[model samples]
Target: MRVTIVMAALAVLATAAFAQDSPSADNGKVVFDKWCTPCHGAVAPPEMPFGGDGLPGTSALGVKYRGELPAVLEERTDLAPEFIETVVRGGLFGMPITRKTEVSESELEDVIAYLTRNNN
Candidate 1:
């Protein structure tokens, strides 16, 4: 009886750990829309005299990957949470690093969940 109780407790702890790591994609979508949509969105208005100033990130990614990968990060099938966190924190190329004050850890987790929802 004692062994069974201990096993159940361990299982519950493990489940909680997993739950904390997954986060909520819905919340993540909100974060992405607020913080990332300006550059990474699929559509943008053509306000510039030369061309549209929207989807810059998408355009850059398209040129960088040469059509081999999707320009949208959210559409990609290969994105790890750790990779997302690192990029957001450290920045890449023209992208600026996000400060913890600008984006809390919890918000970052939500963004990761939204961007990587298609991975699974």
Candidate 2:
């Protein structure tokens, strides 16, 4: 009985360690919603106080890809973690660069994990 109890405890500890090593999509979703959703969401209500603008990034991507790829980043399968990190940090065209203050390193990793969750 004591041996069995010791094995159970070890199993629990192992599971906890594995979980910490993995990136969380839920946390990534929160980061994406807070930062990228404003410009990249599929839809934005026109009733918003910020003038109800449509998704600029989505629109631009649609025009650029011409339906060959998904306009929404999350729906896209061709994205690489490196590309996402570069664009987020360096900005592209009309997009503004995200500073470390706005997005920490760990938060960026979460966002990358969230966006690339389907790649695997």
Candidate 3:
């Protein structure tokens, strides 16, 4: 167990080092489309209240934010890098934790860049 923990820590450190490279928001959009769009996609006008029958994340956020914030992930501009990193890595409410294998540290960094591109 100790060895496993140490190995995991080292792997995280290594990935952190690799994530330092400049991330591309364009590439992040691709990753987001592939991985996050299914649950977090835009809701049509007809689906405004519930996000249709497929977009649970969007619908949930719609209910959670009550219009104070955009439910569509792409439209949100208040995301912070640290918050994104924590939520993506540890999950939040109904969102599942994304493993490094699923979205490598580099990919996560890129996603952050893409999501925060419109931030002030």
Candidate 4:
């Protein structure tokens, strides 16, 4: 029927729209560089003391994980979207909570996309 055909067309259009609106990992990298890179970036040296030099968060995580996980945020593959969301909204250990004004919900979604890009 014509109605069935129209419904299928509409569904296809809706899927296309959703795909376009989905979070972009590329954009997420920009957001992460702006907000998270200062603390979680790989700029810090391995010998850098925690809180004494570059990338305190990286240093702390390095010490905490002790090679079990990646200290650099971008290289991490074990991060879950839900866990990232929770940590971003609620302060985790030394990492402070990220406010919506600072990093919008859309940006947060993008960040999650970027961080989880390597996830299988």
Number of the top lDDT candidate: 4
Sort by lDDT, top down from the best: 4, 3, 2, 1
Per-residue lDDT for 22 in model 2?
73
Each model's number of backbone clashes? 0, 0, 0, 0
Off by over 4 Å in 2: 45-53
Q: Give lDDT: candidate 2, residue 23.
A: 72
Q: Write the per-residue lDDT of candidate 2 for residues 2-116, one digit (tens) a residue.
A: 9999999999999999788777778999999999998898775564354334788887787789899998888987789999999999999999899999988888989999998
Colliding pairs, model 4:
none
Worst 10 residues of 2 by lDDT: 44-53
What C-alpha lDDT do the candidate models reach, one value each? 0.85, 0.87, 0.88, 0.89
Candidate 3 structure quality by residue, lDDT tens digits, 26-54: 99999999899988888543554534546
Model 4 residue 50 lDDT?
32
Badly placed stretches (over 4 Å) of model 1 are 1-22, 46-53
TM-score-wise, the better of 3 and 4 is: 4
Worst 10 residues of 3 by lDDT: 44-53
Higher-scoring candidate on lDDT, 1 or 4: 4
Q: Per-residue lDDT of 1-120 in model 4, one digit per residue for the tens?
A: 999999999999999999778998999999999999889898865564434457777888877898899999889988999999999999898788889999999999999999999986
